[model samples]
Target: MAGIAIDGISMVYTLPGGGEVHALNDVSIDVDQGEIVSILGPSGCGKTTLLNIIAGFLSPTAGEVRMGGTRVEGPGAERGMVFQQGALFEWLTVARNVAFGPRMAGSPVAEATEKVERLLTTVGLQGFGDKPVYQLSGGMQQRVALARCLANDPDVILMDEPLGALDALTREKMQNLVLKLWKDTGKTILLITHSVEEALFLGERLIVMAPRPGRIEREFRLPFPEQALSQPAREVKAGPDFVATREEVLSMIWNMEEEIMGQAEADQG
Candidate 1:
């Protein structure tokens, strides 16, 4: 089971000046195998901090993260990450970038080559194997990043604003591609994004977080992602149910932001 369990997680950063910043407060979440979950929150809400904790890149001051019933103490092959910048080696060819993981793991040449070819085709980059990553468009670079992450065959994929850099059309296309990949691979995915619409579209479960000592504000089980599997994403987004949910979530975040600003003003005054 590739399910994730985050229990009683909290993070406190000790500032150099003698104070402490409470980044997260007893945040706990359970993600079942093959679940696609999206997290949203205002800036400083610790969304990325939570993700980094789950990725084992940072340890919480209290509590632990478990995957497949084992505690996650550090990064492992069972997890892969896709970043906002499509963090690929610009000097490497697309195929080489995708194959980097398997090669590092000492996969046989023939097997790794086969995997790379299949993944390129999976990501719609089949014929562009030899092209340097720098030569690709932003969207194409992201596709390569996706393929590279898939190459590792991780049970879980962590994405932090993976589509945040793209234009509208490209972002929508990438959103659909994400759905397709999730459907085809059945990998557990936890994505952090600022876009409420994207969160609703890609997540079977959507989580909203609040800032001051960050914690889960609300958890919603949404139908849009399942609906999107068969329908055009635009059509799904246009539906009354989807639109209503998006507005509600937007308002929720907006209110949180307002509260934060008010608090800041009070402190200054």
Candidate 2:
């Protein structure tokens, strides 16, 4: 009855040419309740695909994903997702977008409105509620997206590089925002990111995925959530253990380049 379980799963996709693309190979990961774990990997390693499987957006070729002792066959509100692109509805106002979930789940408008109001402020988007999603700044739009995902109060949150599209400065601010939200919510979180620094800063446990036919290559345990934000990220980023962990993760990913290239060739051949 842990938060979520990825049990010995592998996924294969068939291309139009009748060729098989192996996305995952016997990948197994256990995310404990209220813990935040990050998945890092080289490009084309299917890290995102694994995340999708966990979210029930795709069925695994083999094995299963379970949450709260129940099998995950399709999307459910118990698991909320913050996609990389925000994925907000273009036509809805900010408040409407956040209220969308609860309303659909049979919440009365009065209750949904009240919940939306609280969530907008939680993500620092209080006054932006009535603004058209397109009218808000990039950071604010993302805040709305985050609040929207949280409105239903899911037990687990899955993020696929949610801040990856932001400018460097905005990305840092959003990282802190996400950390604060995680602390407040204490939801089990699975984040997939390409940035090593990001993975280190946000994850309580970090799992590095190997090149194509992605498998767990390395894991690191950190006492990060206990670290005070009184110290700047740059200061923590320079710690001996932090540097070593980053290098270890980076080395594993860099070494996978050849393997990914080979897999691509094999598929092409």
Q: lDDT values of the candidates?
A: 0.95, 0.87
Query: Candidate 2 lDDT, tens digit per residue, 144-217?
Result: 88999999888899999998889999998898888888888888889999999899888999898886577888
Question: Model 2, residue 59: displacement in angstroms?
Answer: 0.4
Candidate 1 Cα outliers beyond 4 Å, as residue runs: none
State the RMSD for candidate 1: 0.8
Cα shift from native, residue 206, model 2 (Å): 0.5
Q: What value of lDDT does candidate 1 attain over all alpha carbons? A: 0.95
Q: Which tens-of-lDDT digit does each residue in 48-135 have in candidate 1?
A: 9999999999999999999978999999889899999848998899999999999999999899999999999999998999999999
| Pairs of residues at least 3 apart in sequence or in different chains that clash in candidate 1 | none
How far residue 211's Cα lies from its native spot in candidate 2, in Å, is 2.0
Best-matching candidate per TM-score: 1
